[model samples]
Target: MPLASDPIRALHSLLRSTLRITVTDGRIFLGAFVGTDKPMNILLTETEEFRLGPGENPNGRFVGQVMIPWKMITKIEAQESVVQTRNQLDRDVRAGYIM
Candidate 1:
């Protein structure tokens, strides 16, 4: 069953769960929840660390670990596949179409 089949429920679930977000430009941000007064704008907090390596750098001289509110965010990734699925459903519902 698709999440869009129940838009309200999907959104409720999303709001209730903590999210592991990957921001635009491939930066990861984890937060407790999201708030969006406008569909295009979201607010999140409780972000801790950022990782910029494929693995522990062998050189140990690489630039990794950054703070929150990076300057290159273009989108927010809902870490779980179900979150993505629910987001898609929410969009579909908002569009008055179900998929």
Candidate 2:
């Protein structure tokens, strides 16, 4: 059986969506997905940073637009709607729904 492909398309589908990204240093960033490069570096607009542990701020600091190195990222999360879309895409690919 062939493996499902189109990872690039899946990443593109995440554009313009709100994402919660966690980095290696235990900081979380919430931002609007804007851009990415061949290296997988991410660019986000209307960004905010939330630090964990002591001195945690209830309201995240406004960071405007920022570029996050892909290597620094530990995890990325999207809203339920985006997740559903991704899941559907996976199912469709597995079912040979897309050519």
Candidate 3:
């Protein structure tokens, strides 16, 4: 399918960006957003997993690439730079500024 819609294009623009994903098990993953499927399963590379359980290491461990099922995800956050860039672009667009 072609990525012709605005939302799809927006998502595409975030490709290779850093994302923080929290799972239902209270573990968080920080990785580069690589891909996603129709089921919303996310694929990430150079990932690190941080477990918040007792006795677990506060410093995240590198987990390499991972594919997270959408059902297990509780929250998703983009890196601050990505969010700020998008926000600024939105503001500029609203102000009739286009590049």
| Ranking of all predicted structures according to lDDT, beginning with the best and ending with the worst | 2, 3, 1
* Local distance difference test, candidate 3: 0.85
Please identify model 3 stretches exceeding 4 Å from their true place. Answer: 1-5, 87-99
lDDT per residue for candidate 2 within 1-99, as digits (tens), equals 111256676777778999999999999999999989999899999999999776688788999999999999999888977768777877787699886
Ranking by TM-score: 3, 2, 1
Kindly provide the TM-score of model 2 when superposed on the true structure, using C-alpha atoms. 0.78
C-alpha displacement of 92 in model 1, angstroms?
Answer: 23
Residue-level lDDT tens digits of model 1 in 1-99: 455577556556576355555666555555555554434344555544355777843333322223335344555555577687677766777788974
Give candidate 1's whole-model lDDT.
Answer: 0.54
Position 50, candidate 1: lDDT: 52
True-structure lDDT of candidate 2: 0.85
Point to the candidate with the largest TM-score. Answer: 3
Candidate 2, residue 67: Cα displacement in angstroms equals 0.4
Q: Which lDDT value does model 1 have at 36? A: 46
